[model samples]
Target: MKIGLYFGSFNPIHIGHLVIANHIAEYSDLDEIWFVVTPHNPFKKKSSLLDNYHRLEMVYRATKDYKKLKPSDIEFSLPQPNYTINTLVYLQEKHPGHAFSLIMGEDNLKSFHKWKNYEIILENHHIYVYPRVTKETTETQFDGHEKIHHIKAPIMEISSTFIRKAIKEGKNVKPLFPENVWEYLDEMNFYK
Candidate 1:
């Protein structure tokens, strides 16, 4: 099976996320899209994130109804401040029968060179990149790279940060999330 790893903090899994993941799963060659909920992203501040379990649960609720989309807490058991390279290696060892690839935005491709062992990652795995509405330009080095594939997926402007701020301000952002995810966040009073 070809699995596309859609890694994210998923502060709260929102609709934009599901749209992109579903688009890729249905249109692309990948058989499954795993929302690998990161416990801590090296590029993000941990203090602003919700508890790992809470975040994971939200992802679970959001993706549970979709056959092609599934939630993953693989990074939770791994060491803190983990890098994508390490996680790729660990996943390969655990699921040798499955071939894994990365699902990222064009914006993240701008900083692709800075990731730990990025060259090695490219050598071993294919990357499926979706469009993102960002002003920053992508790195020229990745231009026409064989390991990288540009997927013409929808550009999702919705962000977890925006959703969090809206909730904290007592604004209704229920439409931004999956129905079950919205219910869970509302019930738990998260981000308020």
Candidate 2:
């Protein structure tokens, strides 16, 4: 199976994320797209994040209907401030029968070099880059590289941060996320 890992904090899984994942699964050769809910990202502010389990549950609720789209808690058991390289290495070792690829947006590519063992990741796994609404489709030095593929997926300007802000401001964000996710948020009184 060709599994593409879509890693994120998912502070709350929003439509933008689902759109990208669905697009990659439907349009690309990947057999499955797993939304790897990271427990903690080294680069992101820890204070801004919700509880890891809450984030994971939101992902599960959001992606439950799609057979090809699944949520993963792989990073939860891993070390804190998880790095992509470590997770990829562990996954490769465990799932030798399956092929894995990295799914990311163009914004991540801009700072790809700063990631831990990024060169090793590029050499060992394929990267599918999707366009982000706010980012320009500028060519990176590795744009034409064999391991890096730029896919033209539909871009949504919405973000988890935006959704959180809207919710906190007493704005109805029902249309920004999957139905189950919004219901969970409402029941839990999240971001309010």
Candidate 3:
């Protein structure tokens, strides 16, 4: 099986995430898209993030109805401040029968060179990149890389950060999230 790993903190899994993952799953050659909820991103501040399990639960609720999308807690057990290269290696060892690829936004591709062992990641797996509204251009090295595929998926400008901030301000951001995810967030009083 060809699986695309769409990694994110999913501080709250919103509609933008679902749209992108669903688009990739249907439009790309990937058989499934897994939302790998990260426990801690080295680039992001841990203080702003919700508990790992709470975030994971939101992802689970959001993706449960999608046939081609699933939630993964693979990084939850891994060491903190983990790198993508390490996760790829561990996943390959655990699921040898499955071939893994990456699903990323154009913004992330712009900074791809800075990731740990990025060359090795490119050598072993393919990348499906979705459009993102960013001011910076992508790295020249990745412009026409064979392993990198530019998927014509929707440009999702809605961000989890924006959603969290709105919720805290007592604004109605209900349309940003899937029904179940919104319900869960409301029930738990998260981001308030």
Candidate 4:
């Protein structure tokens, strides 16, 4: 099986996340798209993130109806500051016969070189790059890389950070993400 690993913090899985995954699953050659919810990102500040379980729960609730999309807690059991290379190695060892690819935005591609063992990841796995609000591309870095596929998936400017800020300001976020997730956030009073 060719699985596209959409790794993220998923502070709160929103519509943008869902749309991108759906686009990849439908348009790309990937059989499945897994939302690998990272417990903590090495490049990001941990203080602003919600609990790992809470974020995982939100991902689950949002992707419940999508058969091809799944919420993964693989990073939770791993060491803190989950790195892509380590997770990929662990996953390959655990799940034999399954080929793993990476799903990321153009923004991440801009800083791909900064990631640990990025060259190893590029050589071993396919990377599906989708457009984001800001069109930052690392074309020079991966100009002739056949493993890197540029997808014309629709880009959504909506972000989890914006959603959290809006929710904190008592603005309506129901339209931004799945209704179930919005309800869960409302009930839990998250980001308030």
Candidate 5:
């Protein structure tokens, strides 16, 4: 099975995320798209994140209906300050039968050179980059890059940070998340 690892700290999984995952499953040859819920992202500050379990629950709730889209708490058990390289290595060892690839945004392509052992990852695995609102799918940005394949999915401007702010400000987050997904958050008082 070819699994596309879409890693994120889904503070509260939103509709945009669901859309992208569904898009990939339908368009790509990937057998599954795993939402590798990170306990902590080294690039982003710890203050912006919510509890790992709560965030994982939100992801589970949001992705439960879709079989092709699934949530992974793999990082929850692993050490803190999660790095993509380490997670990939762990996953590879755990699921030896499955072929894993990266599912990221085109923006990350710019910083790919700076990632830890990025060349090794590139050589061994494929990276499918979808168009982000800020990142363009242009040749000029990347000079004939072959490892990076462009995924044509809807570019949702909604971000977890923006949604978190709305919830903190006592605004209705019902529309931000999938049906009942926000209800789960409300019941748990996740953001509060």
Candidate 6:
């Protein structure tokens, strides 16, 4: 089976995440989109992140209804500062039968060079890029990679940071997440 590995912190999964996953699954050759919850993303700040297990659970709850969209804990057992290349290598070794491809925004590709073994990842795996409007494309580097698909996914304009900020301010986030998922988040006081 072909899988689109979407790596993110998922401090709390929102509807935007679901939409992107759905879009990738529908448009790409990928049969599944795995939300590989990063315990520690090398590019992100650690202070704002919630517990990995809690974050993972929230992802589990948010993606429960989507068979193609799953919450993965692949980084949980890996070393600190979870690197994408390392994770991909490990996943490939563990799941020999499944083909894994990278799914991310054009913005992320810009910073790809700084990642460990970024070139190797680019050479080996297919990348599915969905346009993220706010970020600049010129500054983001793709290096004329082959088999890179550009998809027009729904622009939800939402981020986990934005949702966390709303929670910290005690603001309503009813529209941010799916109905049931939002209720569960509120009940658990997740971001608080």
| Model 3 Cα shift for residue 122 (angstroms) | 0.4
Estimate every model's Cα lDDT from 0 to 1: 0.94, 0.91, 0.93, 0.90, 0.85, 0.85
Candidate closer to the true structure by lDDT (higher is better), 1 or 3: 1
Error of 5 at 38 (Å): 0.6
- TM-score of each predicted structure versus truth: 0.97, 0.97, 0.97, 0.96, 0.93, 0.93
For residues 1-192, what per-residue lDDT tens digits would candidate 4 score against the true structure? 999999998888899999999999999999999999988888889999999889999999999999899999998999886799999999999998999999999888888989999999998999999987764434657866899999999988988889889888988778887888888888888999
Per-residue CA lDDT of model 5 for 1-192, tens digit only, reads 999999998987899989988999889989999999988888989887888888888888898999899999998878877678888899899999999999987677778888888877887788888877864544434446676778899998988889888888999879878776888898888776
TM-score for candidate 6, residues paired by index: 0.93
Could you say which candidate leads in lDDT? Answer: 1
Per residue, candidate 6 scores C-alpha lDDT tens digits across 1-192 of: 999999898878888889999999988789999999988877678988878888788788888888899889998999997788888899999999999999988787767678798778978888888878674444555655576777789877898888888898999988988787787788888777
List candidate 6 stretches off by more than 4 Å.
Answer: 135-144
Q: Which ten residues in a row have the lowest lDDT in candidate 5?
A: 135-144
The regions of model 1 sitting more than 4 angstroms off are none
Candidate 4 TM-score to native? 0.96
State the lDDT at 5 in candidate 3.
100
- Candidate 5 regions exceeding 4 Å error are 135-143
